[model samples]
Target: MTLRSTGRWFWASDAEGDRGGPSGRRGGALAMMVVFAAVMGCAGAFAAYRALTGDVDAYLASHRQITAQVLSLGDRTSAAARRAGTSAEVAWVDGSGIGHTGMTRLRGDQVEKARVRIWVDADARPAAPPMGGSGVVLGSLITGLVAGAAGWSVALLARSGRRAWTARRAMAGWDREWRAHADADS
Candidate 1:
């Protein structure tokens, strides 16, 4: 096994004079990469936060909760409430005196005819449960993190694209110079 390996991922700079990065200059590229990563990360976090807040607010505002009963025996292994919880059918009455039936995810053991609180929409249909305080916080945090990662990816792509463009331009410049001095050299 020919050992020809260099730590490139952790250290991707200062390999000039023959085998180096694009553009023949890493100073500006490094600065731009840092700036792009930071800016995009911040922007993504902010944007995700704003969107999460708006969606959460709207969902909570449009939904309400009331007492409901388990109508059918939901499968225990249905994966609906497999995490220390059980799934079952439910029944509820909306504000307009209309009755509705739907499946609900209930915590703990919930047999048939068990009563539980469930979220309902305007048409008395089973809706997504209200986002709890902790859920909101956690969701926002995750969203921000994902967005930050996406932003960083975009920044890296942009930097790589710019570097490639610069390298191509440098190559073209060399080609042009060679063609211009062909006759003179001969």
Candidate 2:
């Protein structure tokens, strides 16, 4: 949907070389890539916004620190490499004096009755730590950069392919012309 009046073409809808020529195909592909990059960047912006605003972190933090009693130990074999803790079933009393139970990580070799600090959400459900502001910023930055780079790469590849195709077509036309004139000089 780019304006071609100014002679600046991003993507060409016609790559078949029969209509708008190879330039059209390359431009059309590039335009699509730009659209994709924009969409990805917008999505990343929304994610960053969500991470920046609201009480997502504060609410979780206010209710996060707690001591829980280990009810049962979990196996560590399935955990990732260098995972410091093993999963365990735990129960703890919230600030409201209400009892809640969940599965959480505990130091390896921790036996039953051992207590550990755990983080819980507003619904008293075990949850991961909230993303901090810096983390959000970093994530959004990386997302935008990656998206832009992807778009550029796509455009570059399409442009090269289009140029090569055009060159081959030009050479073929020249070969046919030369053949037609070859007998004239004989």
Candidate 3:
């Protein structure tokens, strides 16, 4: 058997057979296309990450962190609450000196009148904190890597499928040729 390089793959053939055929060439082209697709996918992921980072930065800038006093703990003894955390009624004043009361989650160890740092919007309403720098970078990198791996897996599956189809066709042709030879000899 002889093996010939087709881009990143090796196409094998018998000693009497020529180096692959149309199917081999098509497979080589497909491989190149898959590589290109993976590259494009990674680039697109990075672009999406940059846009998301900007939006998160804007959110962080618009929000503020303030210390709030826990007035009371609600459902602190519940099994679900204990597993998740205790829900507490907290009060804080925004930059405008307007007082606000809201519900927030705190560790079970927290007690009434305990001071905790919380994020709030301009209206002193409870808000979620934006993604930190390290988290954003790590998340983006993982997403990009997953996308690239998925593309590569699909390419491999397609190549294997094509190879199986080609083999079936070749076998059919060989059977037909053998039958014709047998008939001619009779």
Candidate 4:
């Protein structure tokens, strides 16, 4: 078998040209599959990045950081709580001077009546901080990788099935030809 590269694609042929035979078709299908996977992966990454960025922007626009006074503290029975902080009840005023109270986690050293900065949404309810750039980038990369892998795996499986079916058919044909030849000789 001889392999040739045509700038962007590589294909194989025997002593004679592939001439649209199974090998040539397989080479073409492989190239197409790679292109399809790349397109899908890039599209998935871009979509994820855009969606995450929009969400961050919305959060920044609708949320604000304000100073709150710790009203009380809750118990932390475990040394390894998912939240390694002191649970405290805090009260703050929104942009419109409307007062609200809620429970939130603070540093372990927090004490009652201590002022702390916390994030609050439009409804003056405590909320988590907006996603950072690194988190968004990581999420996008993971999504792209998953998309590409899934597309490539599915295509490879289909190609393998087609190859198996073609080989079976070819073997059956060869058996039929051999039987016909023996009958003629009889």
> With candidate 3 superimposed using the best TM-score fit, by how many Å does residue 153's alpha carbon deviate from the native?
3.9
Off by more than 4 A, model 3: 1-41, 157-186
Question: Which candidate model has the greater lDDT, 2 or 4?
Answer: 4
Model 3 C-alpha lDDT per residue in residues 112-137, reported as the tens digit of each score: 99999888886678876678888778
Worst 10 residues of 2 by lDDT: 2-11
Each prediction's number of clashing residue pairs? 1, 6, 0, 0
Answer with 3 or 4, whichever has the higher lDDT.
4
Candidates by lDDT, descending order: 4, 3, 2, 1
Positional deviation of 180 in candidate 4, in angstroms?
4.0
**Largest TM-score belongs to which candidate?**
4
Worst 10 residues of 4 by lDDT: 1-10
Write the residue-wise lDDT of candidate 2 on 78-130 in tens digits.
Answer: 65612767878999998889999998766657789988777787788876656
Report model 4's TM-score to 2 decimal places. Answer: 0.69
Superior by lDDT: candidate 1 or candidate 2: 2
Measured by lDDT, the strongest candidate is 4
Candidate 4 C-alpha lDDT tens digits along 5-77: 2211222222234544544765687798898788878988999999999999998999988999999988766
lDDT of each: 0.67, 0.67, 0.73, 0.77
Identify the runs in model 4 with alpha carbons over 4 angstroms from their true place. 1-36, 81-84, 182-186
Model 3's alpha-carbon lDDT is: 0.73
Report residue 98 deviation for candidate 2 (angstroms): 2.3
Residue ranges of candidate 2 with Cα displaced over 4 Å = 1-97, 101-118, 183-186
